[model samples]
Target chain A: MQFVRAIVRPEKKDEVLENLSSGGFNAATVVDVVGRGKQKGIRMGDIYYDEIPKTLILVAIEDADTDKIVDIILRTAKTGTDGNFGDGKIFISPVEEAYTISKGTKGL
Target chain B: MKEIMAIVRMKRTGATKRALIEAGVAGFTAFKVTGRGKLLDHSEINVPCKEKLMGMAASDVIDRKESEEQVVTFLDDKRMFPRRMFTILAYDEDVPRIIEAIIKANRTERGAGDGKIFVTPVNNAVRVRTGESGDAAIW
Candidate 1:
């Protein structure tokens, strides 16, 4: 199994979730987080905001399905044609074990 | 690559950020979280809050010393405290530096709740903009 975590702008959260669901990867955990990327944060009117609000979407899926899911996220979460700073990044991590709570079954 | 996750006191976030930057880390994500440690105080758990509440009326509970004690016990039993978690992705060679930076910034000589640092292996990272992967992606 693989754990995929994507951090995207708050405004693009819904669109990304919808696309992921339509792609048949439904189970996800979403969180509101504040952070910055390579560009650090943004400035407006002489004010520097270091922490920008972003939505973190987490999903656990079969290893084979990783590419498809990454594609779905990248396509839906991108801000524009070439993309911009703060467009967000996707990380893939190996999942050692997974279990279904209600069913008491193991694995993804 | 490794993912360094550090859970530290909320008040120490600024120090941690500066430390990470000075250590040459490019970016990281932080979240406000509530969590508790495994070491539970047996003394506080012995006196249940419900029994204390039963000893006094609801209105008088506010002014009584026993009520204040009860509130403390309740909080001790629940034990959850606000913490800031920083998640940083870095190359294998950078992991040690990042971990050291986090520890130096957040560690207190006091007891538990100084927080923890977990290092996990990352299979891959992708930069959405340029379609770069691996080290190129993280930097």
Candidate 2:
């Protein structure tokens, strides 16, 4: 299994989650996070919004499902057809092992 | 650089924090989260959520269904436990030390729910205040 971590604009979080659930991958952990990237931060006419709010969505799925899930996130998280900076990013890492606490079993 | 995320018991958070700081790693982020380990016995409970947030325009809140996304659900199972996810961004050399500190502080003889720790490569990180990137940003 691989863990998929997506840092997305706060507004797009729900859409991403909805897509994931409808696509049959329901288990995911969502956290409220703040970060800035290459653009550094955004500037309005008068003030700068330095720490932009983002939602970090964590999901562990079968290795085979990686592409599909990533696709769903990318499709749903982007701000528009052209995409924009701070649209957020997705990271995938191998999960050595996973266990279920209640059943006391390993590998899921 | 590598990021170490340890999800341990909420009560052990203080000890874990102390251990990390004592290990010479001062900055870290912690969040309160609810999850179930190997048990796989929990059920999801859907809680009602409104389609549009107070400050958002009705058109801005995409109408996917019932006006709100089903993403805002809660776990209804008693078996699901609450855990704290402690995240640390450090240089490559400090990864092992930080992980060790977490295990030493959170692992108890009582067993099982000591929580899980995972290390992942961070392609890059930036210090928002300084506009520094990579190792310079974290160091």
In candidate 2, which residue pairs clash? A99-B38, A100-B37, A100-B38, A100-B39, A101-B37, A101-B38, A101-B39, A102-B39, A103-B39
Q: Lowest summed lDDT over 10 consecutive residues: which window, candidate 2 chain B?
A: B42-51
lDDT of 1 at B48: 58
Comparing to the true complex, what docking class would candidate 2 get?
A: incorrect
Taking all chains together, each candidate's TM-score versus the true structure is 0.49, 0.55
Question: Each model's DockQ?
Answer: 0.04, 0.13
Clashing pairs for model 1 are: none
- lDDT score for residue B75 of model 2: 26
> What local lDDT does model 1 show for residue A49?
85
Question: Can you write out model 1's per-residue Cα lDDT over A1-108, one digit (the tens) per residue?
Answer: 787989999899878877777687755556688898777699888988889999887677788999999999999999879999998999998754443322223444
For candidate 1, the per-residue lDDT at B8 reads 78
- Candidate 1 runs further than 4 Å off: A1-108, B41-68, B74-77
Model 1 DockQ class: incorrect
User: Ten consecutive residues with minimal summed lDDT in candidate 1 chain B?
Assistant: B37-46
